[model samples]
Target: MKEITFYLDFVSPYAWLAFERLPQALEGLSYHLRYRPVLLGALLKQHTNPGPAGIAPKRAWTYRHVSWLGHSLGVGLDMPARHPFPPLPLLRLALECSGDGFVNRFVAGTILRHVWQGGADALDPARLDALRAALADQLRQDEDAPERAKRLLRENTEAAAAGGVFGVPAFEVEGRLFWGLDSLPMLRACLDGDAWFDQHWERAASVPQGLGG
Candidate 1:
C-alpha cells in the first residue's frame, strides 16, 4: 500500500474537518495515513500567510465556503468568533502516535470533535489531562500513562518541524507536499495510483494578478 503523510495542527478548523473526512475518503485507496504534527508559525512565516482567515479576498469567501462545506459533509464545525489559538499540544500527540495507526486516528478524530463540536478548550492543560485519562482507560494503558502521552505530544511537534512540514492539513505522498484540506481528494487520487505527480509538479502558466491596470 502507498503511504500518505498528513501534517496537521489541531488548532485549525479546516484540519479538524479534514481529519474526520480523510478516513472515509481514503477507504477505497490502498494507502496508509501517517500523521505529522507541525507548527503553524513556521509555515506562515515561510509562506507569508496573512492569518487564520487568509487574505482579504479569500477570507471574505471562505466563511461561506466553510458553511456550505459543513452542510454538504454533515460535519459540525463551530468556528470561534475570534481566531482560535493553535492546537500545538493536541497536534504533538497526534504526531507521536503516527506509528500507532489506530490510536492516531482515534485521537485525531476525537480531539477534533472535542474542540470543534464539544466546545472544549483544546489548549487547556487540565482538559488534556482529562483526555489522557480517558484515552488511557480506553487503550488499556497503565497508571501514569497520561504523562507518557504528553511526552509523545511534545516529541511529535519537534519531529514535524524537522520533516519540512510548515503547515497544518498538509499532505505528503511519496515526499511531495500538498497543502490544505481542499487538496485531500487529489492526494487520495495519487495514493490510489492515478499518478497525479505531473499535474502538481509541472510548471503551469502563471496568471499575474493584483496589478493595477
Candidate 2:
C-alpha cells in the first residue's frame, strides 16, 4: 500500500474538515495515512504568502466558507472564539506524542476536534490544561517534552516546506500533492489509477509558460 502523508495545522478550519472527512473519502483504499502537524505560519512564510487570514475581506469569506463547507459535508466545524490565535501550544502538544514526527490518527483527530468542535477559545489556558491531562495517559512524556516538541515542530515544518508544502491540509502521495478540503475527489481519482493522470500529469509543469503576457 502506498503511504500518504497528511500535513496539517490546527489553525486551519479547512484542515479540521479534511481530517474529519478523510476516512469516508478514502474508504476501501489500500493506502496508509500518516498524520503530520506543521506550523502553518512557517509554511506560509517559506512561500512568501500573507495567508488567507492576513487579508481583511478574505478572512471573513474563508470563515464563512469553511463553516458552510463543513456543514454541507456532514462534518461539524465552528470558528473558535478568536481567529489567527497562536497555534504553537497546540502544535507542540501534538508533537510531544510523535517521536518520529508522525502523529497517531486518533491523537491528531482528537486535537483537531478540540479546536474545531466548539466555538470556544482554543487558546484558553484552562482548556489546554484539560486537554493535556486528557492525553497524559496515552503518552509517555518526559520533563523536557516541551523543548523537544518545539524542536521537532521546527524540523517537521522545515522539511514540509522543503517538500513543497505551502499550506495546511495537504495530501502527499506518489510525490504528487493534492491540497485543500475540496481536493479529496481529485486525490481519490489519482489513487484509483485514473488514465487521465497517466496522460496529463507531466504536463502540469512541462507545459510552456508565457512570460510577461
Candidate 3:
C-alpha cells in the first residue's frame, strides 16, 4: 500500500478542485491519504514567491483558469467574496475536526465544499459558525484543541517546506513531491508504476542550475 500526503490551504481554489478530483484521478489505485492544511502564505514567503493571487493579472488568470478547471472536472468551485482571505480559522477548524494533524477524505471534502460551493465570504463569522456546527461531532472542543491545532498546522507547514513542497494541492508519494492541480495526471502516472519516474524523475531536479552572477 502507498501513502500520499495532501498539503493544501483552504484559501486555494486549485486545492479545492484537486481535493474533489483526486479519487477519480487516481481511480483503481489503492493509496492512503494524509490531509495536511498548511499556511500557503508562509510557504510563499519562504520561497520568495508571491503566488498566483499576489499579482493582479495572474490573479485574474488564475481565477479564470480554476473556474474552467472546475467546470471541466465536474467539481463545484466559486470564488469567495475575496481572494487571499485569512485561512487560519479554516485550517484550525479542519484540524479540530480530526483532533489531529490529518483529516480523512470525508472531513476534507466537507470543509472544501463549504468554501468552494458558496460564492459568499468564505470566512464570514456566521458561515464559520455554521460550518463548526456541521462538524461538531468530529470536532474536539477541549481546552487544548485550539492550541494543538495551531501547533500542528505550523509543524505541517514547516515539514512541507523542508520536504520541497512549495505549493498547495501538493501530493507527496514515497518522498517525491508532485505539485499543483495540473500535476494530477503526472501523479496518476507515478501511481500506476510508470517506468519513467525511475528513469527520469529525480534526474530532472539534479540538472545544474545556471545563474549569471
Candidate 4:
C-alpha cells in the first residue's frame, strides 16, 4: 500500500474540511493516510504566499464556502469567533501524539472540532488541562514533551516546505502534490488511476499570441 502524507494545520477551515472528508474519499483504497501536523503560518512565510483569511474578501467568502461545504458533507463546522486563532499549541499537542496513528488522528480531530464548534475558547486552560489529562499516560512517557513537541512541529513544517508544500491540507501521493481541500477529488482520481496524468497526457504548447502583447 502506498502512503499518503496529509499535511495540515488546525487553524484552517479548509484543512478541517479535508480532515472530515479524507477518510471517505480514501475508503476501500490501498493508501495509508499519515497525518503530519505543521505550522501553516511558517509555511506561508517561507513560500511568500498569503493566507486565505489574510484577504478581507477571501476571508468572508471562505466562511460561507466552508460552511456550505460542511453542510453538504454533513460535517458540522462552526467557524471560531476568532478566526486564525493561535494554532502553535494545538500543533505541538498533536505532535505529542505522533507515531500512534489512532492517537494522532484523535488529537487532531479533537482540536479541529473544538475550534470549529467551540470557537476562540477552544484552547482555554480548562480545556487544555482536560485534553492533557486524557492523554496523560502518553504524555508521561516524555520528560520534555512540550519542548520536544514544539521541535517536532518545526521539523515537520521545515520538511513540508522542503517537499514543496505551501499550505494546509496538502497531500502527497508518490511525490505528486495536491494542495487544498478541493484537491481531494483529484487525489482520489489519482489514487483510482483515473486521473488525466495517468494516461501520459502532456500539456499543450502555449501560443505566444495568447500572452499579452
Could you say which candidate leads in TM-score?
3
Candidate 2 local lDDT, 1-213, one digit each (tens): 888999999999989998988889999989999998999998888778989899999998998999899889888898999988999999999988877788888888888888998898998999999898878865646787778888889998998989899898999998999889889999998999999898898877796878978
Candidate 1 lDDT, tens digit per residue, 1-213?
777777776677778778878888777767777665565765667667666466776766776676678778998877544455666565545433443322456666766666777555666778778766655534533554446655555555566666666677888777767777788887777776675566645544244677798
Let me know the TM-score candidate 1 reaches against the reference structure: 0.71
Stronger candidate by lDDT (3 vs 4): 3
The whole-model lDDT of each prediction reads 0.65, 0.89, 0.88, 0.79
Which residue pairs in candidate 1 collide? Answer: 92-153, 93-153
Model 4, 68-149: lDDT tens per residue?
9889989888877777677887777777776432235667777778778755576688877877777665553666767778
The digit string of per-residue lDDT tens for model 3 on 54-92 reads: 899999899999999889888878888887788999998
Q: Give the candidates in order of TM-score, highest first.
A: 3, 2, 4, 1
Candidate 2 residues lying further than 4 Å off, grouped into runs, are 211-213
Q: How close is each model in CA RMSD to the real structure? A: 4.8, 1.4, 1.1, 3.1
Instruction: Give me the displacement of residue 179 in model 4, in angstroms.
Output: 1.1
> Model 4: residues >4 Å from true position, as ranges?
99-103, 199-213
Stretches of candidate 1 exceeding 4 Å from the true structure = 53-64, 80-82, 92-103, 124-126, 137-164, 195-200, 205-213
For model 4, state the Cα shift of residue 106 in Å: 1.8
